[model samples]
Target: MAGMPSAHSSGDSRAPGTERDGGTWVVIPLFNESSVIAGVIEGLLEVVEHVVCVDDGSTDGSAEIAEAAGARVVRHPYNLGQGAALQTGIGYAREQPGAEFIVTFDADGQHRVVDALAMVALAREEDAAIVFGSRFLDDRTRPGLLKKAVLKTAVWVTNLTTGLTLTDAHNGLRVIRIDAARAVNLKQDRMAHATEIVLQLGRTGLPYREFPVEVLYTEYSRAKGQSLLNSINILVDLVIN
Candidate 1:
């Protein structure tokens, strides 16, 4: 709804049947989200034709659930960090027959399907190489105070390092065109890859836009919120790599 020039009802269960239907593939880096993985994939399938879940050694049967939910499942032998899982998913998605765009979505159910669809539409309409979903673009997403502070810190670090002023850098909802997706080479193997992704995509000199998105902070998401220690570790990872 943010970048959409025309009115859109995102609640429509029918796939928009647009250029994005088969051309857009969602890459979700999943690790031990068995309880919500099925619903996440199911919701994605309602909007897009391709959904790829990279199971990062999830022992909780997440891979099976995702496959059963109609997603193409790629398994990791062990618990690689989020960055590795993303690299796997993106690589897998890019190889698909008709993949024109690769969307990086969170497996925690915080990311909304409607937002992803809108971002994809925005990319096609503007001929953008990348469309980043930013919660800070609008007041729709309300993270907790501490969470907000932590995210702001991440944004600061990302902007400072990447030379691109993005409102939300750690947001896991991003629509990257195949050309831009090809530019992604994440090696941090953890949360620090978020910053690295922005830097790499920026180096491509491609057209990009930030779309407003609402991240639903349910109890489940809040329970797995980013802590100060984790933030510090991500910073350390960035510094080291």
Candidate 2:
């Protein structure tokens, strides 16, 4: 698909072409998450319509899976970083025919559709431009000590840089209204773009909220997710940038 697009409406890519009455669009930045991408797409479809997966040059036939499972697939020619994929997805999504809001979701099944819907509803009720899913807002998410420490450190750095006070900086579940989304221009082509997203969105001076969302740290999610080295890389990104 050349165009079109979240409530954490994003997922890792792989699905079929599914359609629905459009209001919100979910953008999933996909890589090699072949096994779980279809499930994520289907789950999101139950709540909202118009799921689009940006396949970040995955080698495991992820784009095909996503298209087959009911999601429009945007394929990268080669392996690009998640930031680039997200930028592309959001950019593409915001241009869709009936788009009103965008959700950035993860493809590994760590994010919940209920949390995404709640965040979207919050945005509508509060007239907020941005709604961020924060695992640290309550006791629902229990990240390991080391992971929490590192993520908390990253939050501090993100707040310092973006001047936006937030409890969780890297939680992938986020709701961005169309105007706020149009203002986003992600330069960080890596996961570091998560912070870049905060910085750019904060500059918009639009209303934002943080809603508590659970992050399921399943064994599979953990294995496919950030490693110690990846965490440190994220930290260094904040420090150096």
Candidate 3:
């Protein structure tokens, strides 16, 4: 694999010969998700054999668990935000031989492999560069009233500012074409990266689409997910930065 950009301060190692045996490479930016990393990797492996878990300075041994589950683990020396983690993973995946597609999935186990595969198919069918998964398109996994309202407002603000009409702007589940993934650059290091991606995609004029997907909000994710204030912060970040 080619050396990662200087932005990756440390922890960019690949398993010997693992990069050559690739198909659909799923890039999962992992934080301290030790409780769920194993299961998440296992579930992802069921659909796609090549799964890259970028462990973003996880103190809870998330890298070990992911590696044990048959995933190619890329460790970060310290805690970078999810956006940075994602960029690291994507860069690593791009270096792999026979890297066909890239999928950005959540480490919290909220995203589904079925939905990801569907998005991949749709990206190929529509000839789109990127395909975003929209929870608002389906009623299977519903957010709470306040959470729904805040996220909806986020979509509105993002569309108004970036001129990209999307139903769910902050959804993490997305399938990006390998060629298009090379052009995708994320600047925002935090929650705001979601909006940054949309804006960047728009500016680059990449063919993109939204697909209906389920986001299972379990009690754990609800407790660990973004708060109301975080939504406002993301909006502010988009406006100023």
Candidate 4:
């Protein structure tokens, strides 16, 4: 919080028309994540004032669960992928009157809630436009050998293409300044949009930082989607697009 203005305590009193400060809204893009969205929203509510959940055409009850958990819900007509879902949620966040920062989180239960708060603090203290969660910062939490090889190749290619040195390029947890986010025009609609985001950030020369984050590989995440083959698909998308 070095560069940011001091935040008022949650119980501090202020004028009726004064703006409230501290943590900003969190945007979680989910697709058929009924089993975990509630917990994600609840965990975030403890630290943030607003939580927006974008339901990317999930036939399941993910939207209902998010709404029930006290999150603002936005529903897409079809499954538009994580990038589009995030874009939709970001649009909603920009419209909020007092939202100063935007934090993008995953709905698959991969990102930890505590790390998200840490990312926010880093964003404020460092005055970064974007703050990403880097799982590779700690060697103990690294992925399997094959997975690591694929990600390393992907990171190398991303660096070559975007000219940005990033240790982990696929992490979903990120915090961004509202102004910097407003300047970005994310057009990718599928999984490849993850890489697209970084490329855009690099092209724009936005200030960004990477922070250590924990990874949770769960049975439900494995069952839901995101196979090893998806890496190939992402590369194909990157090449063709």
Name the candidate that leads on TM-score: 1
Backbone clashes under 3 angstroms, per model: 0, 25, 0, 0
lDDT of 1 by residue, 118-165 (tens): 999899999999999999998988887888888998999899888888
Error of 1 at 81 (Å): 0.7
Off by over 4 Å in 4: 1-23
lDDT by residue (7-38, candidate 3, tens digit) is 22123244444433235789999998899878
Model 1 stretches astray by more than 4 angstroms: 1-20
For candidate 2, which ten residues in a row score worst on lDDT? Answer: 1-10
Q: Write the per-residue lDDT of candidate 4 for residues 11-125, one digit (tens) a residue.
A: 3233446343344878899898888888888777766667889999999889998888877888998898888998899888766666678888989887888898888888889
TM-score: which is higher, 3 or 4?
Answer: 3
RMSD of 3: 5.6
What TM-score do all the candidates reach, one by one?
A: 0.91, 0.90, 0.88, 0.87
Which number leads on lDDT?
2
Write candidate 2's Cα lDDT for 1-241 as tens digits: 2124333334533334644435788999999999999999899887677788999999999999998888888999998899999999999989877687899999999999989989988998999999999999999999999889988988998999999999998888999999999999998888899999999999999999999999999998989877767867776775685
Off by over 4 Å in 3: 1-22
